[model samples]
Structures are given as C-alpha cells and as structure tokens.
Target: MLRLLFVGDVYGKPGRRVLAAQLPLLRPDFDFIVVNGENAAGGYGLNRESFDLITGAGADAVTLGNHAWHHKDITALLNDPRLIRPLNLPPGTPGRGAHTFEVSGVRLTVVNLLGRVFMDAAHNPFLAMDELLAQPDLGTVFVDFHAEATSEKAALAWYLDGRVAAVIGTHTHVATADSRILPNGTAFQTDAGFTGPLHSIIGADPDGPIQKFVTERPHRFSVKDGPAELNGVKLELEGGQAVRIERYHYEEGGDGSAAS
Candidate 1:
C-alpha cells in the first residue's frame, strides 16, 4: 500500500513551528507528505522562506489556496515543481495546479482546486477537473479541494468517486469528523483542519475576529501564539484505490506537554 499524509493549512509561524517539530516524528510512518501552506508566510500568503521550511520538514509537495498569490514575490517560487496552486485559476497563470511524484515506485498525482461557492471568481472547478482527468496517465490521484462549503466538497468527492484515490478538503481550518471511504473506494473528508494555534480563532488571535464579529468592522488580526496543533489525515491506497483513511491530530501545550 502507498501511504500518504495530507496536512491542512499552515496558519503562520506557529503552524510552521509545530510542523517542524512534529513531522520528523511522524514522517517515518508515511511514504509521502503533502501540506497546505497558503497562509504559511504570515497567515496571509506563502513566501520562499516558508516554502523552504515546509519542504525541509519533509513535505514532498505543498498545496496552496485562494491566498496562494497574496505575496507578489511568490510568482517565481511557483515555478518550483513542489508547489501547487488552484487549478481553476485563469489560464496562463503561473504555477501548476497539479504535480506528480514517484513514491515507493508508484506514480502519485496531487491536485489543488478552488471551490466557487462564496469564493473569489475562478473557472468552474468541476469542468476544470474534467479536463484534468482527461489527460493521460494520472496514476493514483489525490485532491486538495480548498473550499468553504462542506456541501461543495462532498459533491466533488462523490462526483469523482472511483476516479481519485482521495479528496480531502481544506480552507475551513476546522477539522471535521466525517471521514470515510466512499462507495467506490475513494477516501473523503470534509476538511483536514489547520495546523496552528489550538486555543484561538482558527489559528488567529481571537480578539481581532471577535471584535470584527461584534462591531461589524475590520480589525487587524495576527497569528495566535501559545499552544498549537498539527492536523492532517493519513490515507492508505492500493491499486489506485483508497483502502483506509484516519485522522491525525497532535497538540502541544504551552508548557510543552503534548497529546495525540
């Protein structure tokens, strides 16, 4: 079986810290690793330094979301084969939406796609996926559907069932409990969750979000400090099908106590 670990969005410095600390302990058990790092730079967008840190921590590929281009300087970094952006972006956009890697002698393709509901304008993800699948020799496939609505994520998972090995949602930052193998052997999870501050508002300082919610006004937010967690899912695939999927969560306290 080909074992793959998909980590959710890395919020900021805290996320990067926990990832660097935990991944080494977790890497030996998996054949390949993929991380969602759109917010790795400063809870906004990725940068060269953040990319290096993630890959140095054992990530084979880093997937991005709507914030993929938040850092204008990242355009050049996008050319790296290890980075993946949303496939539904306008044509001629720099960076690829999917990349393939050889893991344990098997070809594995990792795809990143953005959802349309309540999100920035982009090409239709469904049709974009159709075009992607039409290409030759995809081998075993995995998709990081960075989207907001759970319904949209589920719909795409069901639509692509039996075609892709797994579909794990991102962007929401909150972990979902509904992880299961679909009728056709594909693994599906509504969201993989974020890897960052566990006691804050989705990896950000709670005060800013709370203020914004209460006053209905913009408030500056910063990455939360203190305790953090690493969230992801582990998938086992065989014969181009998902055989099993399990959620992986590890939390570390401010005083250094850790839990799994």
Candidate 2:
C-alpha cells in the first residue's frame, strides 16, 4: 500500500512554519507529500525561495493554482519539470499538468487543475481530468482540483468515482469536514484547509482583515504571524482504491491554531 499526504494551501510564513515543524513527524508514515504553494509567497504567489522551501520541507512534488504566477520567474521555474500546473491549461502551456510517481512499486499519479465558473479562464477541469484518467499503468491517482466552489469540488469527485484514489480540493484556506471515502472507493474532500496562522483571520492577521473590513479602508495585506499550524490530508491507497482518508492539523507550541 502507498500512503499519500496532501497538504492544504500554505498561505505565508505562518503556513511555512507549521509545514517545517510537522514534516519530520509525518515523513515516516507518508511516502509521498504534495503541497499547494500558490499562496506561499507573501500570501499571493509562490516565489522561488518559497518553492525551494516547500521542497526542502519533504514535499516530493509541489502543485500550483491560479495565483501560481504571482512570482516573477515562475514561468521559467515551471519549465524545470519538477512543478506541475493545471492539466486543463490551453495548448502549449509551459509546465506539465500531470505526472506519475513510483513509490514502493505502486505507480502514483497526481494531477493539478484549476476551476472555471467563478474563476479565471481555464480549460474545463472535467475534460482535462478525463484525459488523464485515460492514461495507462495507473495504480493510484490523486487529483488536486484547486477551485473556488464547494459544489464544483463535489461534482468532480463524483465524476471521478472508482477511477482514481482521491480527489482533493484546495485553494480555499478554510478546512472542510467532508473528508470521506466515496461509494466508488475514492477518497474525497471539499478542502484540506491551510497550514498557517490560527489567530489571524482566514490565515491572515485577524486585526488586519478586520480593520480593512470594518473601516472600509484599504489595508496592506500582510502574513498573519502568530502560532503556526500545519494542515493537510493523509491517505492510504492500494491498487487504485483508497482505503482511508484523514485530516491533520499540527501547531507549534501554544501559538498555532487548535485542532478542530
């Protein structure tokens, strides 16, 4: 059996903190780790330094979303062949959208995608996912459908039932309680949550966002620096079937967000 761990979106420094603190504890149990780094760069884009940090933190591969290009050189960085983008990108896009990994003789394939409705123009995720689903030599598969709507996430999970091991949603920092195994043997969740500040608002400074909202004034967004907590999902899959799905939240000392 191959164990797959998918981390929620990493917002900023706070997200980075818990990520670094928990990997050593989780390394022995998870063979492959995937993290969403789109928001790791000052809460907007994934910078080169952040990318290196995510990899250094035990991420076998990193996935990106709509905010992927927030950094300057991400276009060139995506060419390194290590990072993956949305599979539904228009023809001739730079980075790969999907790839396969080998772990303990189990072929694990991971695909990243962006949503349509209520999002920037991207290829149809459903069509893009179907294309990858047709590929062969597939043992276990994981889909990071970075999206904005919960309905979209759920619809995609149902569409991929019995074909892939898991269909996990990202992009939203808020954690959802819908993690479960589908009737068709696939694990699914609306969102894995985020690995960042607990005291702040939605992974940001609670006061900062609150001020911006209450005062109706433009406030410079900054990373919420407080207790950091790591959040994500751990899954066990064998022969393309998911046997278990779990959500994990870890904090640093007393500063991190309490587990729900």
Candidate 3:
C-alpha cells in the first residue's frame, strides 16, 4: 500500500520553518507527499525560495489555490514542471495541475482543482473533474479541491466518491472533523487545517486581521512567529481506493522539544 501524506496551507517564513523542520522527520512514514502552498509567501502567494524550501522538505508536488497568482515570482516556479496550478482553471492556465506517476509498481494520479463558488472567476471544477475521472488506467487517484465554501467542497466529495480514490479539501485554514470513507471507497475531508503557526491568527498576525475587521480598513497582513504546528492526513489506498485514512495535528514542542 502507498501511504500519501498531504499537508495543509503554509503561511509564511514561520510556516516554512515549521514545514522544513517537521517534514524531514515524517518522510519515512509515507511514500509520496503533497503540500498546499497558496499562502507560503508572506501569507499571500508562494515564492521561489519558499517553493525550494518545501520541495527540499520533501513534497513530491506542490498545489496552489485562488491566491496562487498573488505573487509574480511564481511565474518561474510554474514553469518548473513540478509546481502545479489549479487544473480546473481556464485551459490556457500555465503549469500542469495534474499528473500520473508510479511508486513501488503502484500507479498514482494527482489532480489539483480550484472551487468556483465564493472564489475567483475560474473554470468549472466539476466539468474539469469529469475529464480527469474519464481516465481508465488510473489505479489510485487523489484530488485536492482547494476551495472556500463547505457546501461546494462537500458536494465534490459525493460527486467523485465511487470514481476516485480520495477527495481532500484545502484553502480554509481551519481543519474539519469530518474525515471518513465514502460508501464508494473514497476518503474525504473538508479541510486539513494548516502546517504553520498555531498560536497566531489563522496563520497570520492576530493584530492586523483583528484591526482590519474592527476598523474596516485594509491592512497589510504579516506572519506571526511563535509556536507552530504541522497538520495533514494519511491515506492508505489499495486497488485505486482508500482503505484507511487518518487526520494529523502536530504542534512544535516548546523548550526545544519535538512533537511526535
């Protein structure tokens, strides 16, 4: 069985710091790993250095969300063939957001899709998913539906239940408690939370976000440095379907101690 570990959104340098420190220690547990990095660059978009850090930390592939294009530097990262944008985006969108590969003789396919409701103007993720599920050779397929609305995210899980191996949601930094296998063998979760600062405000400085809401003003947000956490899920797939799945929440140890 192939163990796939998928991490949640990384916020900023502090997020990157926690990611770098935790991933290496968790590598031996999984065969392939993925990370959602829509906010790795200063709490907005990911950058070159941040990309390198995450990939260096052992992400087989990195997926983006609505904020993927927030940083201009991503123009180059998208060209690398490893960095992926949303597959549900308009046809001309750059970077391959979906790909198929092999691990220990097992075939695996990963697709990254962005939700449309309450999101930026993008292609229909449902239609895009139809095309992906059409492939017959895929043994185990995984989808990262980066979206904002819970209704939309939940619908997609049911939509692809019997067809795909798993459907995971991202973008909402809050982790959802509903992680379970669908009747059709697909593992589902609304959100995987985040792998960044746990003590701060939704992965950013608490003050700025609070001030903005309180004052009704635009505030340039920043990452808050403090204790950190690595959050994600582990899924075991067999015969192109998930047999077991579990969510994870690991906080950085205080006083120089590490979390298990």
Candidate 4:
C-alpha cells in the first residue's frame, strides 16, 4: 500500500508557517507529500524562498496553478525538477508539468494541469493528458487539477478514472465535502481547500475583495494574517488503484496550538 498526502494551496507567510509546523507531525504517516504553493509568496506567486521553505517542510513535490508565473524571478525556479507548473500551458513554456518521484521502491507520477473555464487560455488539458499518458513508464499517477469550476474538475477526474490513482482539485480555496473513490477506484475531490488565515476571504484580506465586489473596480488584495488552517487529502493506494481517501483539516489557535 502507498499513502500519499496532497496539500491545498498555501497562501502566504501564514500558510507557510502552518505548513512548516504541521508537516513534521504528518510526515511519518505518508509515503509522499505534494503541496500547492502557487500563492506562497505574499499570496501572489511563488518565489525561490517560498519554494525552498515548502520543500524543507517535507514536500516531495510542489505544484503551481494559474498564478504560477506571478513572481518576476519564478522563471528560473521553474526549472527545478521538484517544481511543477500547469502542463497545458503553451508549448515551450518553462518548467515541466509532470514529475516522478520514488518512495519505498514505488514510482509515483504527479501531474499539474490548469483549467480553461474562467481562467487564462491554455492548451486543452484533456489532450495534454492524453499525450502525457501515451508516454511509456508512467507509474501510479496522481493529478492536481488547478481549476476554477467544480464541474471542470469533476469532468476531468471522471474522464481519467481508473487510468490514474487520484485526481484532487485546487484554486477554489474551499474544501468540498464530496471526497470518495470513483467506481473505477480513482480518488476524487472537488477541491482540497487552502492553507492560510481561516477567517479571511479565500486567504486574502476581506477588505480588498469586498471593495472590489461592492465598487466594481480592481482592488489590490494582500494575504490575511491571523490564526491559520491547513487543508488537504490523504490517499491510500494499492496496485495503482485508490483504496481510500480522506479529507484532512487542521486549525491553529492564536497561541499556535493546532486542532484537527
């Protein structure tokens, strides 16, 4: 059996802090860890510092989303083998969208893909995945579908059922209750939620989003700082098929004590 942990989008210093604090506690239980750190740098995009911090916190692979290139210096960091960007980006785009890691003698392929609905234009994820799976030697596959719409996420998961070990969604910053194994033995979740200030609006200060909503104008948003929470999913796979999947949630108190 292989146990895998997939962490949701980590939003800023708060997210980083909680991740750093909790991973050590959770590390021993899982064979591999994957984190979504696209918003790790000031809640905009990842930077080298954020990348190192996440990796140092026991993440075997770090995944990105639509904001994968928000940081001016991120282009260079994308070349790191442990970092994965959206695979459906235009050809010739820097960084790979998929990476393989070996743990306990088992090879796991992690793929990151962006959704096109209500998001920036990108190559068709379905076709991109088809091309990727056609390549030889892909072991027990797992996907982080960073998308805006739940339907899109679900569609892709169903489309790829039985072919991959699991499909977990990100970018929504809200955990959905629907987490279960598909009929074909693939684990699926609408969204894994996010790691950041629990009280804020999707990891950002509520003031900025509220102003934009009320005034109908662009407003700058910053990462919210306060008690934090970490959200993710735990999966157990046997023979490249998911046997179990459970949502994991942890909240931190002001004094930094964590509660599950």
lDDT of 2 by residue, 1-260 (tens): 88889998898987876787777667888889999887888888788888888888899888999988778888887875558778888899888898788887888888888988699999888888888778778668889989999999999999999999999999888889989999999999999888787777767777778889999998877788878777799998887989999988776767344454
Q: Can you tell me which runs of candidate 1 are displaced by over 4 Å?
A: none
Per-model TM-score on C-alpha atoms: 0.98, 0.93, 0.95, 0.98
Residue-by-residue lDDT tens digits, candidate 4, 164-222:
99999999999999999999989999999999999899999999999999999999998
lDDT of 1 by residue, 38-61 (tens): 889989889999999999999999
Clash totals for all candidate models: 0, 2, 1, 0
- What lDDT, from 0 to 1, does candidate 3 have? 0.87
Candidate 3 local lDDT, 77-99, one digit each (tens): 89875677888776777788787
Candidate 3 Cα errors over 4 Å, as ranges: 258-260
- What's the CA RMSD of model 4 in angstroms? 0.9
Model 4 spans > 4 angstroms off = none
**What order do candidates take by lDDT, descending?**
4, 1, 3, 2
Q: What is the C-alpha RMSD of each candidate to the true structure, in Å?
A: 0.8, 2.0, 1.4, 0.9
Ranked candidates, highest TM-score first:
1, 4, 3, 2
Better of 1 and 2 by TM-score: 1
Residue 15 local lDDT, model 1: 94
Poorest lDDT segment (10 consecutive residues) of candidate 1: 251-260
Clashing pairs in 2: 227-255, 227-256
